[model samples]
Every structure is written in C-alpha cells, then in structure tokens.
Target: MIEINLDVVMLKRHISSKELAKRIGITQANLSILKNNKAKGIRFNTLEKICKELNCNPGDIIKRIS
Candidate 1:
C-alpha cells in the first residue's frame, strides 16, 4: 500500500491546512482528503506545488509498504 505522509511534513513545517491550501491553490477539503490518505490520486502539478511549498521531495510525503 502507498501511504501519504502529508501530515508528518506539515507538522514538521508548522503549517496549517488552511495555509497550505492557499499556498497550493487547492481547497482545504481536498487537502484534508490528501492528508488523511482518502485521495484516490494526485496530479503531478499539484504534487510539484506541494513539494515546492513544503520544501521537501515527493519521497518525503509518500511511502510504500508491503
């Protein structure tokens, strides 16, 4: 399974969902879905924006488990 580690990075950066949503130009509800691993998938452009805002790589926000 793939795990979305968004909350970990958000906590590390001390950013709130509202702030991140505004920064990434996404809705807070969408960000919440992503944060809680309820998202079915994410666009690469969105991922790029998130990484840029959070100052982290994709790997920092995603992980794979067996």
Candidate 2:
C-alpha cells in the first residue's frame, strides 16, 4: 500500500494546509485527500509543486508499505 506523509512534511515546513494548497494551485479539500492518504493518485506536476513548496523530494512525502 502507498501512504502519503504530506501532513508530516507540512508540519516540518511550518506550512498550513490552506497556504500550501493555494501556493500549489489546488483546493484545500484536494490537499486534505492527499494528506489523509485518500487520493487515488497524484499528478507529476502536482507532486513537483508540492515538493518545491515543501523543499523536499517525493520520497519525503510518499511511502510504500508491504
């Protein structure tokens, strides 16, 4: 299974969900879905934006569990 650690990274970066979403050009609800690991998938563009804003790599926010 795949898990999203978006909230953790956001906390580390001291970024609020609303701010991140606005900066990344997404809706707060959509960000919540990703943060809560309820998203079916994420676009590369969106992921890039997220990584840029959080100053991290994809591995920093995404995990795979066996």
Candidate 3:
C-alpha cells in the first residue's frame, strides 16, 4: 500500500492545511483530498509544485508498505 504522510509532516512543521494550501497556491478542498489520500491520481506538475513548496522530496510524503 502507498501511504500518504502529510499528517506527519504537518505535525512536524506545525503548519495548518489552510496555510499550506495558500502557500502552494492550491485550493483547500484540493489539498484536503491530497491530505486525506482520497486522490486517485496526481499530476507530476502538482507533485513538483508541492515538493517545491514543502521543501521535501516525494519520498518524504509517500511511504510504501506491504
């Protein structure tokens, strides 16, 4: 399974979803989908933008588990 780690990062950074959404130039609703791992697919462009804004790599956000 692919797990999304946004909650961990958010706790670590003490950043709110609203702040991240504003900083990333994405809507809160869209961010909620991503944060909740309800998104079926993500664009590479969006990933790049997120990584840039979050100052972290994809590995930091995604974890693979059996």
Better of 2 and 3 by lDDT: 2
> What does the lDDT read for residue 27 in candidate 3?
97
Looking at model 1, the pairs that clash are none
- Compute the lDDT of residue 65 as modeled in candidate 3: 80
Candidate 3 residue lDDT tens string, 1-66: 887888787777788999888987889999899989898877888878777877789889888889
Number of the candidate with higher TM-score, 1 or 3: 1
lDDT of each residue in 1-66, candidate 1, tens digit only: 999999999999999999999999999999999999999998999999999999999999999989
Instruction: Write model 2 residue lDDT over 1-66, tens digit each, in one string.
Output: 999999999999999999999999999999999998889999999999999999999999999989
Ordered by lDDT, highest first, the candidates read 1, 2, 3
Candidate 3: stretches off by over 4 Å? none
Better of 1 and 2 by lDDT: 1
Which window of ten consecutive residues has the lowest lDDT sum in model 1? Answer: 34-43
